[model samples]
Target: MYYVTKDLFFPPVSQANRDGILAIGGDLSTERLLLAYKSGIFPWFDPGDPILWWSPNPRMVLFLDELIVSKSMRSILNRNVFTVTFNQNFRDVISNCQNVKRNGQTGTWITNDMIEAYCNLNESGIAKSVEVWQNDELVGGLYGIDLGTIFCGESMFSLVSNASKVAFITLVEQLKKENYKLLDCQVYNPHLESLGCREIKRIEFLRILKSE
Candidate 1:
């Protein structure tokens, strides 16, 4: 396994292990994070562990044209009961994602250092968040690195049923409007699969990521 240093460099995605861990022990500087996303790698590590960068094979991605909104979700959207906002309360959105309990995990990969680093990334306009509000209260949200052409989703949390889906669908509609090519989910997720996210080879993903 490769080890990261002060220099903002990484092994090629092809060098990643079968489990997708590409490098270890890197700081989450804005420059490094940007480079990692552009290169099909992302940071994900548990607390008290060295920062682990991964570039998984068979990347999970959603083409803007392929988003699948279930009938129930469509009804919820039609009702317009929840308000959605962009870049509003990013810290809260990410913090909630970090704190929310998920199945099969004792802790979150979105550590305090990761949060601070990505918050800085947010201030730089490279990281983005989608907030869902119900009756003026923040209920659910998602956050990620927006590379202009493709969105690399990091994490999402929902306090109420379908609130995260609402935030996700809303973000997809906006990205579709802007003519985005893809939404990179990074790894396999049944929830994302239900929303039409499917896996493609890492090479294909990298080609798309670098495409003009």
Candidate 2:
């Protein structure tokens, strides 16, 4: 565990504790966030808590070629019921993700400061968003940092069943076309696993993360 200060620096990822918390207390400036992501680190802290930066040992990632699209998802894609757009209405997307209530969590990690920081990244074209619309009404969306080689997926939300899935699947397809190295999912969860996201050793993740 490392305690960050006013400096814009972070310790090596190898020094992180078992839980992947590398360092704490760094400003969410666009420069720092970009440096963290490029170094295979990301900040995830609850409101009122000090900032926590993480670089998990078994990092969850989606290899572009290994994305799993279920038959049902394929059917939905073919139906064309929802229209998908990229980098459109990003603030709305992140806000929806911020407000969504998860089953195990009482609050959102996407705090107000986080919204402004990432939105700054979006304005600089370093962050990107995917919007899903049904008949011109936004129903689902996702946002993340785009590193050209890798996309660091932060969060997503859906107002209806399969809307977020639609956004995710479409993003995967587009990323594949763009020849992105992989989608960095950060942590493990059933939902991400269902989409063919798997854990890789931190060393391996860093290798790929820097190979670009």
Candidate 3:
């Protein structure tokens, strides 16, 4: 376990523990966050805990071509039940992600500091948010770092059924149209699995991240 310092550097991802925790205690400065994402690491820790950086061995990712849009989701997409936009209402999207309750989690990892940091990233065009609106009301959305060809998703929230799914699927479709290479999901979960995200070896993921 490495402890971060004022110097902006991280140990190689190869040194990450079995659980993928690479380092501890680092500020979420835009510079550091950008560097971390480029290096295939991301911050994920409880509110009170020092910032924990992870590079899981089997990195979960979604190749745009492999995205699974279920028949119901396709029907929803065709219905145009919700309007989606990018980089619109980013602060609200992240805040909702912070407050939305999740199963097995007592609190949120998206702390106020995290929100402020990523919001700054958004202002600089390095971070992005996808908003889902219903009748002019923000119902669901997601935010993440955009590395040109790779998008490192951080978190998402939904107030109504399928709202987040709509945001996600729309984002995937847009990325595919834009010729994005990969969507780095960080870790595996059933929710993402249903959307066709799968785990790949960390080395393979790094290769994709570094590829043109």
Candidate 4:
């Protein structure tokens, strides 16, 4: 059962009873968004779709220390192919992710409302971006929310070959530097598996959310 907020804008669904949906139809206010993140829920919906929240059962995450840089990737890193930065050109990073054409995607989930919401989060110091640049141009990057000791990676895109990988690798290295414990990837994919993401029960994930 989903519980509606006093304003009839937000839902109060139990984390354990997400039903693959934590909430529906709510404005992305700072307070509400913060509360949602604290409870391991996140908003994900299309432009015309109502605000849909999700909290999957088996959470996918990557520990900074557990990142696996394959031999080939290691070679690329060794050659110092691309340079990376953090919290710089966040809007550009997300814009690229949203507009870049992919193999099987017709459009992006990063609606204009979503962009404004996240940019607000960034201004409030809750969300951030990692950028990969070449020849002083933004080639690839990723965006996410950064809790005290956790980074919830949302999405990434690459304009040049392996550019996204470079951005992600830089993010992990920086996380290690900051002593961050985990990078929440949200879902499982072969690419993430190759980069060392693993699955954990939601209960355990919530514990980390609390501890972090």
Global fold similarity of model 3 (TM-score)? 0.98
> Runs in model 3 with CA error above 4 Å?
none
Best by lDDT: 3
Whole-model Cα lDDT per candidate?
Answer: 0.94, 0.94, 0.95, 0.84
All candidates: TM-score: 0.98, 0.98, 0.98, 0.92
Per-residue lDDT tens digits for candidate 2, residues 1-212, read 78888787899999999999999897999999999999999999999999999999999999989989999989999999799999989999999999988789888999999999999999999999999999899999999999998999999999988999999999999998999999999999999999999999999999999994
Q: lDDT score, residue 125, model 2?
A: 97
Worst 10 residues of 1 by lDDT: 102-111
Please, what are the lDDT tens digits per residue for candidate 3 over residues 81-167? 999999989999999999999889888888999999999999999999999999999999999999999999999999999999999
Candidate 1 TM-score to native: 0.98
Better of 1 and 3 by lDDT: 3
Measured over all alpha carbons after superposition, the RMSD of each candidate to the real structure, in angstroms, is 0.7, 0.8, 0.7, 2.1
Candidate 4 lDDT over residue span 66-139, tens digit each: 89998988898888888888998889988888999988778888998788888899999999999988899899
